[model samples]
Target: MSFSRIAFTVTAFFLTTSALTHAEEGKFTASPGLQLYSLRSQFKLKGVSRTLDTVKSFGIQLVELAGTHEMPIPEFKKELESRGLKAVSAHYPYKRWQTEPDAVAQEAKELGLEYAGCAWADHKSPMDEAQAREIAATFNQAGAALAKVGIKFFYHLHGFEYQPWKKGETLADLIIQETNPEQVKFQMDTLWVVFPGQDPVKLLEKYPNRWDLMHLKDLKQGVATGSLSGQTDVNNDVTLGTGQMNWAAILATAQKVGVKYYFIEDESSSSESQIPKSVKFLQSIRW
Candidate 1:
């Protein structure tokens, strides 16, 4: 056989194998992940090692962090690597983003993280235009700084942003419009969005490119919403398939909108039991 013919045959064989592998599992299978903050209380009491072991046992190699539990950056990264865990993104305090964004970005790089962001911003309930603009400025500053160091920065939404702040506009609208999309991205926390009587699917449709990550949370049925409190009962968190979220539609929309990571964040007392179930739920979802 000619060399070109042999090469073509080998390439065709691998392509066929690849196509079969993808056909077996459709395009939307959920990958296993964890938001380390799900075990924040336990980590505070038992130390990072215990919580990390628990995370690994759940088979979640990717994580979104809340803090280091006082461990140094290098030591924490080493621990994650040792346990087969990878840090996809880490949330720093809002103040840290404001005061020392460069250091935060540098640390994310050192930890081998792909993204860095803030979970919440300081704002009064019924967020005024001034406050919205102020937070947008902070995001602009931090996002630009992180971008300079090769790390993407994002803002995680709390439920409060969904409250009406103007005529047909929520405070989130302000943040969306004010911040430069190239510099700042968003992560939709499903529970937080649902907790506020907002639809995650709609948000994804509205600003397709603005969101790039997700905290794949779910809420218990019959929970009251339209809240601007930004605080909620931890018990409201439920297993992925058993909650108020429409996982299929949301996941489909997320894929369309270019969300890159999905981290399960269970903030209830039963996370030990729920994480496994959530992973199974994601693995089983089709479409």
Candidate 2:
């Protein structure tokens, strides 16, 4: 074959493969939720309202709140509701909940949030295994308290919990077994699940209805490896259809197990641009 013919044949092969992938995407349905963390940079650039307006423009009806920028809970809720958005979930630190479980639960209830959770444990304080175990105990107790107020609690994994703990069990496994599924559920962030060298599909299957919420974040290859402790840049996080995840099977399993929410969490600095692309991809898919 001539050089041009060889190049044309190679290109055609990839084009066909792309077509098949796009066809498979038709099996899944897109979700209409936002991960508030995606606007971190933009919020700092313009302001909270501007960032939120952008999110609302994306047709997002629900959001998973990261933190409220020190804004009062009622005021934050008001702002969100005024723009026709519902506060589905919020990330509450374990320490604050332990200090005043009632206050946390009351604040969450006031915000009209169905779920309150921790994005991560207090790993900043420098602790050992025993200390970590104690912290888990406090989280479970606080979770139980939150449940009394008609709020469900969740533990959001950030790849750290994949570390091996007692009896060859990962910290994630321990958390799942220890926490009461009725009061405390989990929110698996697929990027972090893959970051920890774990298969998210397997984890989702193992736990079943234990996960009521999820962060649908994708990761690019060559960003980091082995664990979250490795310094990986947020720019390395990419949009859904543009990453290295098996999204079809992932979404299929979530649907199978009846996940209540799938919040798109774009941590990349270019979230405003990338989020729309991800939304467009989701809109084209079905399952």
Candidate 3:
């Protein structure tokens, strides 16, 4: 072969290989979706259309919903679709799941959701074993019903379930043990796990495959933890890497345990300003 032709062929091969490598890295390094509840105040103050525009401005294409901002379900779904946003999961009130799970499933289908969840268990303060068991039964029933409709069910831990139980186990442990894994799954809100003084990495290791989703939130540094109240000032939420979380360790464990979806959920009043920063941080993570 002519020397010039050999050189051209080699350069073309290297160029194609480099392009493929970068494409794969981009797929791996892309940031997770935003939880729409992060902008609850904006939705209320600026109206749904404007608030969603702000979300689209962040270059996010996937989202998790808390509610539809009172829009009809089909209308809300259409709005999301128009902006190239997909709703992978949504949270419904616990009562709605208990009283009318089929209705919840119907609405979830209308929104084209993959998973439906409850963010809080609605139990008395300092949640006890009985309350935890009751919550488990509700989840099991709702999960079964939702499963038939091709929607999975999940529970978002709210910190209060960390209350102590016998043999050094938590009420949270009891609930996990009682629920049917085939039907029920869990979402770990990083802030809630940290706020209640629990180790997210340890939990991920302790219960692999049961946690199907994650809320990528961070807690402000130097704040007190170990509260079982499951409540905190919304302002304690900070941008992803600017907070107290050891994100590398937590995310590594999450990936190892097969956690499927992640959403950046910043509930601070400053969410509008903070979300883009969070997205940048997530994109910078290598592992």
* lDDT score, candidate 1, position 68: 86
Higher TM-score: candidate 1 or 3?
Answer: 3
Instruction: Point out the higher-scoring one by lDDT: 2 or 3.
Output: 3
lDDT per residue for candidate 1 within 1-78, as digits (tens), equals 999999999999999999988775444655757999899888988888988998998888899888788999889988
Clashes of 3: 0
Give the alpha carbon lDDT tens digit for every residue of 1-287 in model 2.
99999999999999999998877654555456998988987777787788789989998888999888667877787889889998899998777867888888888888888999888687742334665576578778878888898889888878776677778667678778877778888898888888768888998899997988888888896655576462368887898878777887888898788788889998887888899888887776664
Report the candidate with higher TM-score, 1 versus 2: 1
lDDT of each: 0.88, 0.81, 0.91
Sliding window of 10 residues with minimal summed lDDT for model 1: 23-32
> After superposing candidate 2, which stretches have Cα over 4 Å from the reference?
1-26, 124-132, 166-168, 228-231
Give me the runs in candidate 3 sitting further than 4 Å from their true place. 1-30
Determine which window of 10 residues in candidate 3 has minimal summed lDDT.
22-31
Q: Is candidate 1 or candidate 3 better by lDDT?
A: 3
Ranking by TM-score: 3, 1, 2
